[model samples]
Target: MPGPVFLRGDTVSMRTLERDDLDLLQKYRNHPEVRRLLGRVHPQNRDKVEQDFEGYMSNAVNLLACVEEDPVGFVALFDWNESSGHAELAYWVAPEHQGNGYASEAGELAVEYAFDERRCHRLDAGAHATNAASRALLEKLGFEEEGRRREHVFLDGEYVDTVLYGLLAHEWRD
Candidate 1:
């Protein structure tokens, strides 16, 4: 059977991420600028990427974002706590494709999926303090900044604070 459409926007569509996508997805994941903000801790080769992909895909609702035929990025609703109706959100677009708003569109779709389709009570997200673009995207999607963990992530030899954001289902708009 075909998979369901997890989310779709004007220019982007999201679907279940399959094993076949690992190679190209890994290329995007390895982009220095992309990994820098994603808080990647270690260098990732194909094997490492495949391993991580399997682990994540098996547990979460991860969707590959595509612009027609070309994969641009991905968005995910994971770390679910069914009892509490909560889950974490994550999204990223290829660094070269950053300016096209793919991340924002896909992220909005994921938020809708979490709140409307999944019936999640709340969704959480985090962004590095220095990543203003990502922070702005969350803000635009109706996520409110809830807190900040001072120097929470050690990356590239230094630590960076992670800004927390959350949106409650009742607070969401169509």
Candidate 2:
């Protein structure tokens, strides 16, 4: 079965998550390292993944980042408020694939899709205040810091601040 191709980068392509991709997705999403930064609201079990794949996916753009058919990461544009032309951006790369620019590549495509194709005026992303890597990536993608929410989420053992970032359509180069 063919999956929907939403956007393409130089080394990675972002495609809609398909039913056949559930197992492959589970492998990445359930990884301890990958899940640590996601601020996951629920466990990524087979049942929930399948359920979300079928229902929640329809409201947002959730794409897998693949390199020559091998899944390396994921980019999601969720919580879209069309009336406000805004959405939340999220992504995670496998432990082995970090520092390769795959996430940035996939993120560029997703942000383009959100601003250029989807006509969204703003895209929001938040990272654990301690996550320097994500903060750097967001900066590389032209996202500006909006503010920080102190002790916004409880993760691992204690609460972590949420560093908010935003990109506006007018600020997009393309």
Candidate 3:
């Protein structure tokens, strides 16, 4: 509900993103396959990362999925406004951790925070249509597809539709 902190679930635990996580975050950053799946942006260097962390300080809603003290992935809630009582969710599981159910588990806890703890009325997110894995994860978490924006993102040299999905506070199940 406030700043990110350690969140424990059955199979994994999520901790707040920290500057000390640079090495682990960089591991994902430098992995070619991981970068490709994350949309192949220009590689991030140390200076850029330093600035990125500085930016996160103001935005400030983020979580890191961990297991046995090892960094596995990240999940974040943002776009917060007290009056609106809603926030957008986003997450990424490292390539090595992709098939382990980490995102879904961590995502559930984040949703709980937004709806139960933070008293948020709605939670929403979008994924590229081609990202079947992400789409399936959202659906499994009870999010419904609301709409799609055709050719909204330029990915891999071609336009891809962005699929919007959402779940209301009343729609959530434990």
The candidate scoring highest on lDDT is 2
Model 3, which residues run further than 4 Å from truth? 1-5
Candidate 1, residues 4-107, lDDT tens digits: the string is 45567899888778777777767767778888889985677999888887776678987888887577787878899999999999888887788898888898
Angstrom error of the Cα, residue 89, model 2: value is 0.8
Ranking by TM-score: 2, 1, 3
lDDT of 2 by residue, 59-131 (tens): 8787888887677888889999999999999998888988899988999999988998889999999999988
- Per-model tally of clashing residue pairs: 0, 0, 0
Q: How high is the lDDT of residue 24 in model 1?
A: 75
Off by over 4 Å in 1: 1-5
* Per-residue lDDT over 77-154 for candidate 3, one digit per residue giving the tens place of the 0 to 100 score: 888866988888888888878898888998998998889888988888988899999999999888999999999877
Poorest stretch of ten by lDDT in candidate 2: 1-10
Residue-level error in angstroms, candidate 1, position 19: 0.5
Q: Could you tell me the lDDT of residue 47 within candidate 1?
A: 93
Candidate 2 C-alpha error for residue 147, in Å: 1.2
**Model 1: number of backbone collisions:** 0
Question: Which is better, 1 or 3, measured by TM-score?
Answer: 1
